[model samples]
Target: MFKIISALTLFISVSVHAQTPDSLLKPSPIKTLTTQQYNALIKGEDQYGMGLVAELNGLPSPDRALKYKKELDLSPTQVATFTKLAVELKRKKIEMGNFIVTNETKLETMFRTKKLNESDLIFYTNRYGLYQGELRNAILQASLKTWQLLSPQQVNKLLTFKKS
Candidate 1:
């Protein structure tokens, strides 16, 4: 009886102290974008931005127009008109991106090499604001186009799943 009780106690203690496998203990999966997916999404966004700008600015490029039109199931004429606007917008966006990149370096150089001044800071801030405005317009235009393409159900799904 004593030996049996000792064995039972040891068994219970060992079982109670056993560690769960790390894999089984893992938390629930979180939805997140992979690096590749993020890059693709960014590319898709630029394409969308270009499409909107071309449509709004009256300089349709077929490539830019098709990007949005294919997604939206728009007619050929609508695609053409919108593409023109998108292309123009894309051109502006490219210029803006480049300008910002260049100006960032200019600011760094001013601080590191030349010494920062009030006028330099003001100029840099103004350029940044301008770049921000251009980007904001592009994002709004793309979102508007996307909303137009998505159905009510699709929009609901998008809204529900969208992280930010």
Candidate 2:
């Protein structure tokens, strides 16, 4: 009985020690983003699901529109339109993404340096929200424009493919 109790106590102690929550208290390297997020942001890719909302709602992304161009029997003019829209969207997204990353870096620095204050925090957070909204709008508007360029049959085909 004594040996059994000792073994049980040892097992419980080891389990508790191994389950320490130290990782939860540790600060992230960038504060605002994980490594993957930082990489995606720098590459002009959407790190958030902002664009997926439009994509799922019957609006294809610029890349998808181009990919299915042959299947959709897109005319030269329609292709040119999509190309221009995509270029504009990419430029705007990159600009907005850089702004967001710069502000996030500033916020991270303030927190790391222990200089964060309530008013500054609120201001920075709101600024970040505005930038995010702008970025999402740009992507969504591109999606809408792409949808407009597609014929009704092409739209149905795209939707069917998406469902599959």
Candidate 3:
């Protein structure tokens, strides 16, 4: 009886002290982003789902327009134009994203070192807004180009595709 009680006590204590394996712990999505993901965002990977703006304007992005080129009966010229626009837009987004990321790092360091002033803060924050606006504008411009390229019938067909 004594030995059984001791074994039971040891088992209970061991179980209580057991550690959960690290593999069993779930990572937080917001906090556990990998470096590649951070780099992609800094390099303008559209982390904020900004492509939705094109859809809101009743047009597809250059990439999307290209994707549905067959269904839209796009001419070879239209295809060439969209390809150029997509490349240009990608470059613009990266440029703006690089500016914004550099500014953000500077602002963060300044704040950490207690070098921030009201005007400086406003300037930095406004710059962020401008960078975002420019990114959004580039996306919209591509959408506008796609809209111009497609006919009304093609637009209707694209809309139907969007629905399904």
Candidate 1, residue 118: the lDDT equals: 96
For residue 92, model 2's alpha carbon misses the true position, in angstroms, by 2.0
What local distance difference test score does each model get?
A: 0.54, 0.81, 0.78
**In order, what is each prediction's RMSD in angstroms?**
13.1, 6.2, 7.5
Query: Which ten residues in a row are the worst by lDDT in model 2?
Result: 20-29
- Which residue pairs show collisions in model 2? none
Q: Please give, for residues 66-156, the per-residue lDDT of candidate 1 as tens digits.
A: 5544444566665655566567656766676556556665776787677988988999989977875776576556546644644565444
Which regions in candidate 2 have their CA more than 4 angstroms from the true location?
Answer: 1-29, 162-164
lDDT of 3 by residue, 1-164 (tens): 99999999999999767844532455322233444444655566877767686787688887887888998899999899999999998899889867876777778778778998999999999998999888988888789888988889988888877532
Which residues of candidate 3, in runs, are more than 4 Å off?
1-37, 162-164
Q: What tens-digit string does per-residue lDDT give for candidate 2 at 52-144? A: 888778888777877778888888998889888888887887888778878999998998899989999999999999999998999999898
Alpha-carbon lDDT of model 2: 0.81
Candidate whose lDDT is highest: 2
